[model samples]
Target: MSDWEDEAEEPSAGKQRPRAPASTPWMPPQSHKQRSYREEGGDQPPTRERAWEPRGQREGDRGGFRRPEERSWSSRELPRQPETVTGGGWSRDFRRQEANRELASAPLCFRLDSSVVGTVIGRGGSKIRELEESSGSRIKITKGDYDSEVKIFGSSEQQDKAKTMIDDLLERYDERPETDTRFGYKEIRPSRSADMSTTVTAPVKRGINWASLRENREKYEIMKWADLPPMEKNFYKEASNIASMSQDEVTRWRKDNNNIICDDLKEGQKRPIPNPIRNFRDAFDHFPEIMSTIKKVGFDRPTPIQSQAWPIVLQGIDLIGIAQTGTGKTLAYLLPGFIHLDLQPLPKNERLGPGMLVLAPTRELALQVKAECSKYTYKGFKSICIYGGGDRKGQINVVTKGVDIVIATPGRLNDLQMNNFINLKSITYLVLDEADRMLDMGFEPQIMKILIDIRPDRQTIMTSATWPDGVRRLAKSYLKDPLMVYVGTLDLAAVNTVEQRVFIIPEEEKRAFTLHFIDSLKPKDKVLIFVGKKIIVDDLASDFSLQGIAVQSLHGNREQCDREQALDDFKKGIVRILVATDLASRGLDVHDITHVFNFDFPRNIEEYVHRIGRTGRAGRTGESVTLVTRKDWKVASELISILERANQEVPEELFEMAERYKHFKIKKDSERDMIPRQGRWRDNP
Candidate 1:
């Protein structure tokens, strides 16, 4: 600063310092000139040059300066232009080209609320980067005070895909509440579109006789309980109270039999739930042929389910029977169905279709029910079993011909009904067997479609081993004031007759353990080995075959004939060991199965119960050995609870494994919570 002041105060040898005009406008000082002069040589001073001097005065009149107004406006000639160019034409053309370029390169823009920006961006912009990579777009979020504009630079397709992804993400986020355990905070707000309602109306189908259908339904309802003959009414009343017990006696009886009854009726409207039949004569004293069939099968009084279900079903009431597999559920429904079919108000000739319709979840179950119908012959009635993977033409042939009973899987039955090959209007007795399994297989839509054609006044009987929410919903939707007869607690429990044992082992050791178990089996011992995957069923079956063990494999991938043959062989003891997937978990009835080996634990606890139930049947004690690994820790706690409820020993390792998994899950959730997340969006993007 001292040197600069010295230089400014004193002039150089041949130069004089010029003073700034008092009225001159302030101009920004150029330090670059000083820097250049100093860079050249600090000893010499910089030259003072006036940049605003007119061109005419610059060279010819350097001694004096002229004012800007004195100079002529048109004194300087403009640069030459081409012949085709006009005033500002080139400028206009340049601007037009620039505008077109900008239009072509413009990015896609959208707006989102400020709060949800962090959620979209994720921790450290991970979610945005993922979107960009997946969509082949460059996303830039320019945040404002209240909102943000998302600019996506990509082709039209990429931009559209990115937008769809973001929309889907936000939609999913809005559907489930967000919770942070660390702060004990939860976002319980409703979605932005929660207030919006969408109403959809289904159009009526043409070419259907609405009036005739209504008339038929009215005629069917005319045969209700009040319309039954006096003699038949007396028989129902006697059968219901034949084994009557005191309130205390009834409670003790239910507890001893492990029966849980849930009748959906008000206290004033409730009727006394029937007690169990003491013997075959208690309920079927009037039906000698049924008594003969029961005697020929064996001297068995009646299973708890059959005992209680017969009276309620016989009284023309809807029944929901929940019992373990192999608890004579089929007989409970079949006998009532036979009686209902025989007692139809409309005679066989007057009826449009079969008198009874049995909906099974699987082909095997359908066939088994058909076999049961065959076993207990009632009035020489003809029955047909139809399912997918079977001969469709043959099924249609059987349906076209007169049949009294129709047992079918929902898919095939729906197909037949849709094609007008089967008529459900005349079905007076309906039975939905294995209702839980059917729902599990996603047959609800088909079941609904099939049920639509059946008369609403028909008697409905639904049987299931487990009472899941889906089955409950189905029952509520279809059944009218049904009485629930559960053999045990509604919670999933295996047959108490089966002894459950679990072994915690590595996945690789499963095959060895199975082989060892097979070696230990007695000559008469029949076992069913359950695996998780279809390929594993084949692999294990082939491995057992290589070991010279007669094993039959059953899975969904097999042909219908092959599956039937395998099940038949297993039942007849041709193959003592049956290896299968969960396909055989339900509806597989083999009375002689002495053991159930779970080579691989099932994916769910319900399947596990069904798998073990395959072994113990008809009061015969059996055993089940399951192999558990670390990967199955998700179901470990549930397995322990099932074991404890059944009074079976829970292994110490299972408890430890469940505890470790719980800790791991907690740590994972905590780490996931550490990620950045924003507040709810005011409006969707």
Candidate 2:
């Protein structure tokens, strides 16, 4: 039987069944799987199936199952929102916003009952200003023949407040809108609550497209999800439960295997999006402006992620993308956002409230995302990067003035939100990049709060290098029926583009070892040095400088301007080496970084992967050398696995070192006192 078919019909050995509670999350039913399998005429379609599959995949798939510790990142009082609110027209419609969120300045437009429109608007537009000031918002009352659209512009808090005040004012006229007398029809009104305000008033297009009624069912493949019949939504509703991974556990997979799991696939099962277009010419056939902009930037072909991702995103599917850094993941999300905006533009003259939000784990990553956005938005797209340590007034001014895209760190975003510097009510596209790190840094409360405000109508896209319990919990909490895409191995490991080497040396000898290796690198090649602490980063940089090596340091202690300058210098080849803590590991992307030197080997493989990922990105070949000691034996096995996969030689001595700590481990209740193993090494001479 094929992977799509039910193996349970002829099972032998025990296999774990998917155990996630059906009520908490949604998945396509098994009966539908049977039907899909039977209907599919041919054998398993030829596609990119590789290193790892979903956690829930059974015997047929090469599933890597590791039960994460049971823990809740949700230590809050926020009420759990139902997946789909039941039996309320306004409630259902509120969650289903159809506005052009790409326009940051689009106002909240809602229909006010014609009977009470006069009461809310008041004479000579008098009450509008009063309502605006009282709720810290701007209001515009545009009256139609029977109903009026009371447009609101402000922070979500302000809009919610103003909507409430308007609702209370309109309470003076309790009677329903008067029935239309000309048609002899008693008003068969769609039910609506007073407080509800929808951003789009455009009539929803209905009826089947004749284009989809062709021979051989060709139209079914090309039809956009937005234009698909109502039943199509339900068809894709039942998909697999999406989750995340931890930073440790080394698994190296190739990018050529761009497999994506959709609503039609079972758990751990993935199928690449069909008809994957190769270049801009084909992919952007419908997106001419975007195609022109990309061509101007000299992009001839879309990266592996972009080629597969663009088609799915263009279909308006909520996506969870897993691709290595420097693979153009930013453009994968941003380009789609731009295309969506172009296709369904916001009303002209709207104020600047970002319709699309890209949340990154760190300031550096946020800035990078913004920089990439600027390139793609060459068609007069404006964006701002928000993080702490920059000018607060400048951020507030630019954001409030208006921007098409907003890239921000969670902490600074939370700060701006509290001060009413920005509003996310109309945010249609949400991208959470490096989501696991955000949780690792304890930004759960801030992320959760932001989600609460933009709960309904938002299309969320979360991407992370590894899938940890935290990321899994987050995916469960916010996303609905999201499509999970895995370009490489889902397991945590270094990017395949880098050549790796590990040397077992004493801790005190690491300095000399790194210096020896540094002397061998090309003078112009940028080298990144990773240490465990900020003090180590600074001390190493200072020591390297005193030794006549041009090096710079980056960590939390350095001023924002200094950090930016350090990165700038490194990128420009003015600085040859950069010493940094793990802060620069994940999101820091610089092209042509020839080498990554690990002065102090990290305790886990996750840190190792992220550090090396900085070097070999965007199809560039790079090298990573690690100075290991007996203390790092816990990670030695995984490190060996990485070395073996990369076709690099692993010294047999590594096993000898591994035996020292692997067999007789340190006991938690040991009676002996802990002492540092200061290795005896030859002096600097």
Per-candidate TM-score against the hidden true structure: 0.65, 0.59
In model 1, residue pairs whose N, Cα or C atoms come closer than 3 Å (at least 3 residues apart or on different chains), thus clashing, are none
Query: Candidate 1, residues 29-109: lDDT per residue as tens digits?
Result: 424344335545564332232234544655565555455442332232223322121111111122333323322334555
lDDT of 1: 0.75
How good is model 2 by TM-score? 0.59
Segments in model 1 whose C-alpha atoms lie over 4 Å from true places: 1-235, 239-244, 265-271, 672-675, 679-685
Candidate 2 lDDT by residue in tens digits, 282-352: 55665578777877888767887776666667777677777777787888888778765544445424633
**True-structure RMSD for candidate 1:** 21.3
Per-prediction tally of clashes: 0, 11
By TM-score, who's the top model here? 1
**Lowest-sum lDDT 10-residue window in model 2:** 230-239
